[model samples]
Target: MKKKTPGDVFDLHQKIQSELNAQEEKQRSALRRSLSETKAAFDFFTDLGHDSTTAIALTDIALANVLEE
Candidate 1:
């Protein structure tokens, strides 16, 4: 097998980093969608004459937990 050079190592590192970034972005997108759905549910509950205070608190907690992940 041919010995790898510094340039080859650098290229491999770049490829790995690029893949990581892509995966991170995908996760972020999924989190955003989840948050949006949660917000919608909160709004729906509020519009249906449900207790606003409880709904707001629950929503806040859910969002905070998801964001902490």
Candidate 2:
């Protein structure tokens, strides 16, 4: 096998980092979408002053606790 040069190692490192950055950007975008949806739902429930609003609040708390654990 041929020995790798410094430029080859640098190129490979840069490629891997670029892929990781792209993946992270996609995840951040998805999270933003989910957050917008959740906010809309919360506003709907809150404006109506329905019991479901309480449930939503509780569910949010539960999810927060689970994620912390």
Q: What TM-score do all the candidates reach, one by one?
A: 0.74, 0.69
Tens-place lDDT per residue, model 1, 19-57, is 999999999999999878888869976887779898887
In model 2, where do residues sit more than 4 Å from their true spots? 51-69
Evaluated at residue 58, the lDDT of candidate 1 is 74
lDDT of 1: 0.87
Model 1 error, position 16 (Å): 0.6
CA lDDT of each prediction against the hidden true structure: 0.87, 0.80
Which has the greatest TM-score? 1
lDDT of 2 by residue, 1-69 (tens): 999999999999999999999999999999998788676766676677758758589557655775699
- Which ten-residue region of model 1 has the weakest summed lDDT? 58-67
| Candidate 1: stretches off by over 4 Å | 53-69
